[model samples]
Target: MLINCVAYQEGKKLADIPIEDISEYLSHPKCFVWVALRDASPEELATMKEEFGLHELAVEDALRGKQRPKIEEYGDSLFAVIQTVEPHGDELTVGEVAVFVGANYVLSVRRDAQQGLVGVRARAEREPHLLSIGSAFVLYALMDAIVDRYFPIVDALEAELEIIEEKMFASGAGAQRDNIERLYELKRKGLVLRHAVMPLLDAMGRLYGGRVPVLVENCQEYFRDVHDHLARILGRLDSVRDTIGTAIQVNLSMVAIDDSEVNKRLAAYAAIFAVFTAFAGVWGMNFEYMPELKWHYGYHMAICSMVIVCGYMYYKFRKSGWL
Candidate 1:
C-alpha cells in the first residue's frame, strides 16, 4: 500500500492511496509519500525504481533482500536499509526493510509486511502528528518503533539466562547445555542487528555533516535521539553477550569442581579396595603351612580388619571435608 503523509508545524496526517497512484500523489508539496510494498514482482520493482529515479546501487540493494543495513546518498535522496526482527517460534525471524528518503517523500519496501510495518503505517494514519512532520520525523519514528520491539526480545533472553544461571549454581550443568545454545542464538541476532544499525549511524552522521537542508537540520536532534537509543540498545545486547559468557564460565567451573569431588571420592574407595584385594589374594595362596586358615575366627578377623580400615578412611575423609 502507498501512504502519503503531509507534515505541518503542529502535527502530521496521512492519506492512503493505491500503489499505482504514487506519481499523482507525490505532486503535492506537503506530500511525504511512503510506498510500502510487500512481495512485489521483479517487474513491478523495476518499474518503480525507474519511476522514482533510484540509483542502480540502491535498486540492487533492495532486490537483494539480505543486504546488510546501510545508508547511501543518491543524487537528491538518501537510501537506507534496516533489518526488523520477528519472534518466530523459539527463535527470531529477521527480514530487511529498505527505505528511500528524499526532501519531499520517503519510500519503504519490505519483502514481507507481516513483521509489523503494517501497524506502524496504520499508526501514522491514526495519529495526526506523524503524517504532518515531514520525512525525517517519519524516518526516526519508524526506526524508534523497530528499536522498541528489540527490548522485549532481549528481556526474554535475559530472563532465560537468569534461570540458567540459577541452575548453574545448582547441580544441573548437563541439563542446561541447551540454554547455552539459546544464548548463542541471541548473540547471533544481536550481531545481525549491529551490522544493520552501525552503518545507518555513519550514514546519518554524514548526511548531517557540515550542513544540512533546513528541513533535515530541524529534525537533526530527533536523529541524534534515535542514534542514542540505538546505542543504548546495542549496549544492552553487549551486556547480555558478556553475561552469557560469564554464565558459561560459571558452568564450566562448577563442572570442574564436581568432577574433582567425584575423583577424590573414587580415589579413596579405590585405595580401600586395593588393600582388601591384596589381603585376599595373599591368603588365597592356600599353602598347607598356613596356620591361620585352620582357625574359624581367622575369617572373622580378616573381615573385621577390612571393615576397620574402611571405617578409619571414612573418618579421615570426613575430617578433611572431602566426602
Candidate 2:
C-alpha cells in the first residue's frame, strides 16, 4: 500500500508519489514522497532495485530478511534495517523494517504486511496536511511510533519485576524458579528491543551530522527527537536489568531462609522421636530380674514418661520458633 505525502505551502500540495516508491520523486526538491512497502515479492524487489539503484548486497539483505539492525552507506543513499516490535504469545517478536533512503525521498519496506505502515498510512489519510512537511518528516513520524512501542512493553516488564519482587519472599522454590525464567525472558526482550532501536540513533546522528543533502534539513528536528526517545528507552532498559539482578539475589536469600526453617522443623521432630526410641529400647531388654517387670504400674509409668518427653520437646520447639 502507498501513502503519498506531497510537499505543501500556503495549504497546497505540489507533487506526490507512492509512499512505498518514494525514491522515484527525488529529482524534484520542491516536493517530497514516502512509500511504505510490506512483504514485497522478488519481482517487487527487482523493480525497487532498478528504481533506486539499490546495491546488490542491500537487496540481498532485504530479500533474505534477517539483517541485523544496522546502517549501510550506499553513497547517494543510505540503507538501514530496524526492527518493529510486537508480542507473540508470552515472548515478543521482531519485525524487519528495511529502508532505501535518498536525497528527497525515503522508501520503507517491512518483512510482512500484517504490520506494514498502517499507522502512518492512517495518519497520512486522516491529515492531508502532513504531506506539506517533506519526506524526512514523514519518515520520522512513522519511525517514531515504531520506537514508542518499546516504552509500554518495557513498562510492563518493570511492573512484572515489581510484582515478582513482592512475591519473591513468600513464594516457594517453584515460584522463585518461575520468576528467574521471567527475568531471562525480560532480558531477552530488552535485547531484542535494543537491536531494533539502537542503530537508528546512530543512523539519525549520521544523517543529521551534515551527511544528507540540503533537503533533509527541514526534518532534522524530528530525527533528533527520535534519538532522544531512544536514549531514554536505553536508560529504562538498563534500569530493568539492574532490577532483575536484585530480584535474583532476593530470591536466593529467601530460598535459603526457607530451607533453614524446614531443616529446623525436621530436627525438632527427630529429637522428639529419639526420646521414645530410647525409652523403648531400654525397657525392652527382657532380663529375668528387671526392676520394672516386678512392678504392676511400670508399664503405665513408662507410657506417661514417653508422653511427657514428647510434649516437652514440642513445647521447646514452639518456643524456639522452630515450628
Using TM-score, give the best candidate's number: 1
Off by over 4 Å in 1: 1-15, 18-21, 125-130, 176-179, 207-215, 286-296
Q: Candidate 2 clash total?
A: 5
lDDT by residue for model 2 (1-323), tens? 33334433322455554435345455555544455567777787787677667788888888889777776777666677877888777878877788777655567778752455667655754555655665555566677777887788888878887887777766577777777777777778778787776777666686565655455566777777878988898888889888888878877777778788899999999999999999999999999999998999999999999999899989989999998
lDDT of the candidates, in the order given: 0.69, 0.73
Runs in model 2 deviating more than 4 A are: 1-29, 121-133, 209-218
Tens digits of lDDT, candidate 1, 1-323 = 33332333234444455556667756666665666666556676686776567787888778778877676667768777777777777766778778877766666777643665767766766766655677766677677677677778777777877776766666654655655666577667666666656665566664454776455665777677777777777777778779878877766777678788888988887877887898789888999989879997999998888889878978888788777
Worst 10 contiguous positions by lDDT, candidate 1: 1-10
lDDT of 1 at 120: 72
Instruction: Tell me the number of clashing residue pairs for each predicted model.
Output: 10, 5
Model 1 TM-score, 2 decimals:
0.85
Cα-based lDDT at residue 66, candidate 1: 81
